[model samples]
Target: MDERDRAIIRELQANARLTNRQLAARVDLAPSSSSVRTRALEERGIITGYHAQVDLDRVGRGVQALIAFQVRPLSRDVIRSFEAFALQQREVLSVFVIGGGDDFLVHVAVPAVADMHALLMDRFSKRKEVVGFRTSLVYDHTHRWTVEPVIED
Candidate 1:
């Protein structure tokens, strides 16, 4: 992709609701050309599906935590099982099968600290593969929607 394509992606990332005319104006391209480029980008999988960013607290999930786990006998089966179980859980927002000292990083949102404790004691503690785990309460979370990866010449 060229500079114009990158610009188009940036604008869309900022606000996916922009019309073809608006996007074209921002990227200094004609409406038809912008639409074509956008469609091509989507077809090529560079532009994925759009989604609304929701506030967890507003939706009754006030408590957020990142639970890190260290699995015993870290086999592929054990990892996959845990990942699948976590994905099926209602409280789990996202899961990362990470490396380093920890095996998995699970982001969860719940109603309260008591609910989080219940989840840890009831759900995770029952898992045979889990050797140890730690929870860190999230006070604030911020992320950027518009990200342009550095391209080398």
Candidate 2:
């Protein structure tokens, strides 16, 4: 992609709610041209899709924890089952199967600490694939909503 294409992507990342006309104006391109380019980007897989960042608190899930798990790597099949188990749980926001001291680092959120603990012990600990686990409560979370592409020095 060229500079203009990058600019379009950057603007979309900042505020995806912007209109086609507004995006075109911000990028200093004609409306029709901008629309065409944007559509082409979407078709070519440059722009995959758009998503909404939900307010987890409003949705009754504010608490967040980073749960690290040690898995019993007895076989590839066991590891795969562990991965599937984590994904199937509703409280698990994200799961990463990694090659490290801890086999997985799972980002989870639930209504309460009690609930989180229950999920860990009842759901996760019961699985034979899971050997051990450690959890870190997230006191606060921050996000960088906009990131500009760095030009080479």
Candidate 3:
């Protein structure tokens, strides 16, 4: 992509709700040209879907925890089963299968500590594939919503 395309992507990443005219102004392109470029970016799969950032604390699920798991028999079937089970759970926010001491890292949010305990003992601990696990409560969370790919010189 050219400098104009990069500019358009950067502006959009900062604010996906920007109008074509506003985006064009920020990127120094004509409104019609900006619209066409945006459409082209979407068609090329460079621009994906937009999303809203929700505050987890404002929601009922204020308590967040990261549960790391070590599964037994480290096979594909066991891993897939564990992943499917975690995804079906309501409290689970995200799951990551990693290559480390822990096989999986599960992110969950709930209203209370009791809910987290129940989810651990009743759900994950009860699974035959789960050999061991550790839970760590999250005191704070922060993330960057907009990210730009580094351009090589």
Summarize candidate 3's per-residue lDDT along 71-94 as a digit string, tens digits.
999999999999999999999989
C-alpha local distance difference test of each model? 0.92, 0.86, 0.91
TM-score against truth, every candidate: 0.87, 0.80, 0.82
Model 2, position 77: C-alpha lDDT score: 87
Model 1 ranges with Cα > 4 A deviation:
142-153
Ten-residue stretch with the least lDDT total in model 1: 144-153
**Candidate 1, lDDT over the whole model:** 0.92
Clashing pairs in 1: none
When sorted by lDDT, best at the front, the candidate numbers are 1, 3, 2
Worst 10 residues of 2 by lDDT: 144-153
For candidate 1, the clash count comes to 0
Q: Give per-residue CA lDDT, model 2, range 1-153, as digits (tens).
A: 788888888888788888999999999999998999899889999777787888778898899999999977657888778888899999988889777688889999899999998998788999877889999999887872445463632
Candidate 2 CA-lDDT value:
0.86
Instruction: Kindly report which residue stretches of model 2 are placed more than 4 angstroms away from their true locations once superposed.
Output: 74-80, 144-153
Q: Is candidate 1 or candidate 2 better by lDDT?
A: 1
Better model by lDDT: candidate 2 vs candidate 3? 3
